[model samples]
Target: MTTNIDIIKSSGEKVKFSLKKLSASLRKSGADEQTINEIIEKVKEELYNGISTKEIYNRAFALLKKKGGYLASKYKLKKAIYELGPTGYPFERFISAILKYSGYDTQVGEIMQGECVRHEIDVVAEKNGETTLIECKFHTEQGRNCNVKIPLYIASRFKDVKAHWDSKQHETKLEAGWVVTNTRFTKDAIQYGNCIGLYLLSWDYPKDNGLRNRIDRLGLYPITVSTLLTNREKQFLLSRDVVLCRDLIDDLFFLDHLGISETRKSKIQNEIAMLCKH
Candidate 1:
């Protein structure tokens, strides 16, 4: 099949599929050119008009997993982020961990007083004496983009919280508000965020400075990305606020508590070590 084959994006927009983009993504997963070409050839055989990116990804991921679970874990990082859901709290913790590793002091699930009310912020990140009230939009399913209404609501809430902070004579000042998500933001949402000076972060926003980019650059793959760990074990780790695989390296007691055998535990450690090397 040619690149002309129409494919549906997660946002429900139809676009021509590009093999080059697919190759680049596979390469980022550390797949060699021969393996990438083979996977592309297999994927091309399954191509059809109106196929969703999700299906294409599943096919590619299954093929990659068969080759090696470690590489497949990197290839399926986006879906692993989705697996942090069913509730947004795990995602909040995940985001907080990302910030913490990036040299920011972060607090998750904070209930603080706004100018006129109390607000439960998803994450409050501080660095360089500037605090940012970050609200996260976590979506479990694909294709759910954050639209203008989300930023609109966040902007107003940010204004209220910032007002409270600015009114105080404090050492750290509330500098900006951020709206982050595990998915993409609509055009209008991004435009609105820019116009109001609110920082917006999502799966692929702000070009190379997005959440995925940060996670990859910092080797902050979520523990859910571990192919060796079962869902129950992953959830157990999440309950203990262990989000990143890098963090799991330091917290092997969770595995010990779950009665993971030494053979399997060593293998899991090996996989995490490879992934965290970035």
Candidate 2:
């Protein structure tokens, strides 16, 4: 492999490619070292100056998918999150599912009265007497990021809603506001979120505790991560408010409703079980 060949990131930044990073990601997918080496070699053969990281990923993913089952599903985590949307609604529901599994009683798209106006919070999570208002900034494009103005605007809305919330309370206190995005946040966004005591969770933020980390740690992968499902099947599950793999496991009736064959049903169930076991 030519070390001098540069690659373009989704952010449009160009940098020399790192075989180490690529290898590490594949290893995280539980791919055997030999398969990873083979994929790396094939990917390297396709590389050229200014190749988008997205293309590199697609090549690697296609190779992995040929191995079939949960391997491809696990490797496609980032892309799977993107498939959760064409709209932010499914992403919000996905986030809500994550928070719910994390032991927070969660609601999606709940309206609350602010000091001056009403706000439809993307997610309202309450746990251990602390209530947090969350807004999900979902983007279908991998190259897009949540910029500083996002948090700037969200923080202002938080203040208004918190003002109203603080005036009266039952059990939970309006403790903090959070902004979560599927993609990365700009450095300024991260800094501002910290400055205002607002929590920001993105793909890889908060040190080792970003949104991706949370999902990996808790095994609450979105239904979009299923390698065994078609786009139509995935969209159908999302429409039924079945976002998490865990949700699908519990609501097996949806499988019957979709007329999934018993053989395919068992395989899907097994793949999900293996994924959660990660």
Candidate 3:
């Protein structure tokens, strides 16, 4: 029983709100149908023409938090990742960590020599004797998408690396060139990646292998998603390169470095323990 509600996106474009789309996202986060319906009904009541999607998202998230805290936090994963950086370097480290959890040996900010020029790779991951050169495209803004020209540029860099390696008699070979981003890719970017066989992992691209899917599969959420911490606290942790929830768990003393009270640190510790549980 939803109306034809149009909402404004972060990009300032207007589009009709789709309940089916909202429900699908909720379902992916493991929300029961009853809870999903309830959230939808509540969000519908607040909808209006030119309503921002962030407003809708916030309303739905608040309802979901009341219904299920974990699911609500999980829904915040992408935005939490947006909090990971004022730059892309931390995101490159974050991606390296994700790859490591998936059984790949990873290194960040590695410079690989090319025939014509030296290329610096954001991440270099190896698994089952295959190596992937990853170029991380990160966006601090929510609505920006990686475009076709990015892949075109990455493809050129991959050629230089390949050409450099081809001239050598080395044991390691290039398995793939990947452009991983915290946001989505444009239609042309996906098509270009498919046509060229270069890998692309954006927020929700490539079916079940997108960045979100991979993160969900492993439950390797970043520390930025914690409900126990404020936005300023999260940014402080990110500044120290403490991006993952597990990082705090591994070193509880890191919380003390934040100049917060012991009680707050304990709350954060408990929340991290719950959010990062297997």
Candidate 4:
């Protein structure tokens, strides 16, 4: 019987092969074929001899992430792997890489003291004299349920912070707190987050349009990956096929740190439609 680990490992291997094929296809699309090859080769050369195939795919995907003009292709690769089932480790790693690329000085998997006991925050990022803690959740479906544990966990940790950390005389204080989920947050959770000044992020949100803008404003990445990817499981709805196309529209509306109204949603959707046609 192949365990989930076995499947994950096999899928990683397949991703390596798929990347090579993708590189070749890029040649026909007027990509810098030689540069692409060199990049892929360097990635392969750095891999351990017995590294799981999923890891190889991750390594190559990470390389492509650094390369420009390949966002759609990257998404395709991600979707394919996700369809193979949850490769939690690789998925978490992918998110971590993206976060680091954005600029946070990140740490993963450490025990943080919560209001009750020591709880772990998946990723903790500190940069430019501010600290931001992130809790990440990966779910394959939507509407299943948002985990209540995250807010509680964050509340506990935030409560643990010394009052001096936010003193009036202090030059810097924690700027924001985030809970990043692969799926959308529930209405209650979103309201709670807003009430407490905690921000929520989801992978389904557009990078160019939504989260990227926030990250840019906040200057949040270039953080290390190990400081993220905590072991917490929650279930939520998978992205509907339509959701993929709506990414830009949804992002433009939702990215407004203020709030989005139904009228604004319609306007943004129109704008997105026009942009997509162009």
The top-ranked prediction according to lDDT is 1
Query: What's the CA RMSD of model 1 in angstroms?
Result: 1.4
Residue 136 of model 1, lDDT score: 95
lDDT by residue (222-245, candidate 4, tens digit) is 111111111121111121111222
Candidate 4, which segments miss by more than 4 Å at Cα? 1-88, 142-153, 161-172, 204-278
TM-score of 2: 0.96
Model 4 compared with the native: what TM-score? Answer: 0.42
Model 3 lDDT tens row, 1-278: 34577788887888889988889888876789999988888888887888898998888888877874467777788788998878888899899999999999999999999889998999999988788999999999988988899999999999899888888886678869999888888999999998998988988888888888887778788987787788888887778878788888879666787687988777777767767766
Error of 2 at 47 (Å): 1.5
Off by over 4 Å in 3: 66-68, 259-262
List TM-score per model, in order.
0.96, 0.96, 0.91, 0.42
Candidate 1: 10-residue stretch with minimal lDDT = 246-255
Clash count, predicted structure 2: 0
Q: For model 3, where is the 10-residue window of minimal lDDT?
A: 66-75
